[model samples]
Target chain A: MPLPGPLQDLVAEFQRLPGIGHKSAQRLGLHLMAQPVEAIERLASVLVSARRALSRCSVCHDLADGAICRICADPARDGGLLAVVSGTREVLALERTREFKGRYHVLGGLLSPLDGIGPEQLNIRTLLERLRDPALREVLLALEPTVEGEATTLYLSRLLVPMGLTCTRLASGLSAGAELDIVDEVTLARAFEGRRPIA
Target chain B: MLGGNAQGKTNLLEAVATLATAQPPFARKDAEVVRFGAKDAIIRSSLRRGGYPLRADLCFRTQGRRAAQIDGVPCRRMVDWLGKVTVVLFSRADLDLIQGSPQGRRQMLDRIIRQMAPLFHDEEARWSRLLVQRNALIRHILTGAATASQLEAWDEPFAVAAAAVSRRRAALVRSLAPRAERWLEVLSGGCEALGIGYKPGIPGGDESMSIEGPEFVASVLEALGKSRAQDLARGHATVGPHRDDWLARLDGRDAAGFASTGQRRSIVLALKLAERDLLREAVGEPPLLLLDDVLAELDPSRQEALLEAIGDGVQTFVTSTHLSDLHGAWRARADICQVAPGHIARPSVT
Candidate 1:
């Protein structure tokens, strides 16, 4: 009762997913095997096409089938108000909010000193080059509000300030409808320090 | 809250997890749980020995057809099946646990406890409901529809539930302290001392005045009466465990305000490891450990600590772009998966 080599590999592949266990992997493998050959071929084709067709966007390092992603190609976007992000998914995330009308520069990742992701590892050079274009004015950083994010923000501020572009980090404080008293001291302090008077 | 990047990884995890977690920092309600593309999403996980089957079915419509099922059976009540399955999810955003807000730390504590003690979840749910009702009553008082007298009536239930919550949190924090300190020492090489304390609003540590369901209610009522004007103006309950906080100290200094980024991350790792051990102690088995690209964020020493924590084979899931970021020990025990675009493959096995 030996399983086929391809089937065994497929089971092993399914086991690697986030929540799928060995039992679930076996079940998925069986289900895939039970599928019509055409469906299995279609799944394989879709995967291959996606891998072959999609690549990093030339300007922003986001996923794109062309040299430039649609966001970069869109002339309506305000390049001056560029939003610097960490991934292609982030670009789409901001777009879904429908609030940002600016172009983007995806850093691919933040500066994690422990992981050897220094300033050189990110697309900081390209980001600086984008800022130097004169059309870029404000660079909104929408990276996750983590320590690495803070490091990235500090690095960008130093790089962009000399170039005279205004740098901004996404506000990190209490969530909407949350109480001030319940919030931690650091968040409360940040809220106070970062507060602006109502005009 | 489902699609590409906003794929609701954190949100979904939170939604399912809240049932097992007590007095979470998020402090959200069931109504607030549904958003954008979902009408009502039900999370039904079964707790089993070692591993159990889980099914989460959302009852909604595309054109106009509503349906729900779990393991192929029509889902009746989502809560009925909770604690039936053990779930562990990993996401890149979990780096926040190591480098983000105190809310994350508090949540880590609550979630671990919820998985261990189901009664804590019930207590939290009841307390949350009471808090909301009390807040609404305060809003009414602001509008003159309710009086200060109304606050006394609500205080009984609010205080009773809030006391239960405060006691549980304080007890849990006490339990986690030793494990947390040990983990911090291992990760940071004795460079820092990590200590976490529950800062419940009530100061009465006396055994006689300690806490009981009725006494808690009466005490809360008195506090509400005292803060009536303030609560009315704010349109929310002002004095309760709902407004409590967890204080994290690194060498006796507030970790959030004073600790360096590296120090904060070390403390966070200590807290999570403490959670793993605490959950195992409570449940007689370790919960599934999820390391979402966090190995890359840790220093080599911290990475070793992480490897040791996750190496117990209590079932772990880790995601990383670079395979080399994984410690050699973890890689030895791990089954690697490569994810790109729409395809996920096991290239190593192939």
Candidate 2:
């Protein structure tokens, strides 16, 4: 069956979406046709508005309509404590904890050598630049504790420790409330190594 | 076109995705998805929700079986079966779930919403339709046939739809926060504070996720007015939830960058368990947990912990290349089945 001119183009476009198929494209086309003119008009308006409005923050690459993201904009954040993360979303995750009263540096990604994500591809330079701020105290390497994260952290620590910044890492071990025997060896080792002084 | 070694895994996954999303998975005319030297292929999958089962059967010639059924009854169109069954897949590629490209995370977030709220899939489709029109309008303007002044005409709808997507994701994440945190605690053993945050393309400027309904629409409109010129030169629009992502920070650090391999797996597992919890809370029941080759990746202890977390209630389908890896604990709870080249059998497990 031949679809009408505009409808055929619409179907083609619909098929380009994350998971829509040709049949779905037709259903959507028919659904669009069934809608009130205002609905169509309203949808069209929203699509344009969303595209035009959002921007990435200059400092963090986080979605921002302003010059800086809310986290970057907030004055209360401890400028001294920098939690290095991979992307804007992780920045949001830290913010939700309300536990970390520190500023963050979004790395944009981890160091994946196989996929060609190296130190240069990530925001390592920017992180180094962030250290220039005199108020900076600790550069908490907040990346995932993967080999890449470890490589990045080790790489950063080599640079950061010499710079005299208090380089700390998030503790790793068997999770609380989980069985000890089921914990992986590496985690078990980390648990023993990072064991704190008995209060 | 799919010829790489890793590509086969991706292709198989895509085929399943194509089936799940395409309403009548078998009705499509094109069936060249199989690899070379394979005489034929048969894809049989069932979509079930709320105990309602709809089956999709696709047979190929160069590719063999093509048929579909809803409730065991024959069906003609794929659309009839879509949105009836939903699956959420988080692969190793999801390492970027926190740290990689915004586009990757955006798709992940949308997938969560797409599963929970089917209408979101439709609304997103509608939004995409408008995006194409706006892009076409821009293309026309670039060619001097249309004026840039007309850009505002499209920005209005763009903002509204984008705002709707942002609000839905925000609300969904917000609603799921407690569960996410709880699951994180159980998975991580409460050592680190678990946090989940939503970075909206356009911030509502309020902390409690206040952006909802027309207010979000209004704010989005205001934003579109702000970024109009940048959109024209780029040949595409920037900003919005399409560009936003969820960030996970574990104990004041980036979960992706700071998390170890085992930690990343733990976090991802936590996320999966969180989704299970979220579904159970949002709806009254849990979706079947399909553990595909995940046990091999986990150590014996983590494996036991994982099984413990899943419990016995939720229906789970686990697959492994070897049975020894899954020995003890879960073996009894799971119905054992075996699969080999062109064969499947139920082997007794003592």
- Per-residue alpha-carbon lDDT of candidate 1 for residues B8-92, written as tens digits (9 for 90 to 100): 3344345444434312124454445445476654544453455555554444332333344556687443333344434343344
Worst 10 residues of 1 chain A by lDDT: A111-120
B167-275 per-residue lDDT for model 2 (tens digits): 8788877776667677768766777666777777754433344577677777777766666667677866665666666667788787878877877777767777777
lDDT by residue for model 2 (A8-95), tens: 8888889899789779989998889889999999999999988788777777666787878787898988888889887777887877
Looking only at chain A, give the TM-score of model 2 against the true structure: 0.73
lDDT of 2 at B192: 61
By TM-score, who's the top model here? Answer: 2
**TM-scores of chain A in all candidate models:** 0.83, 0.73
Worst lDDT window (10 residues) for model 1 chain B? B1-10
* CAPRI band for model 2: incorrect
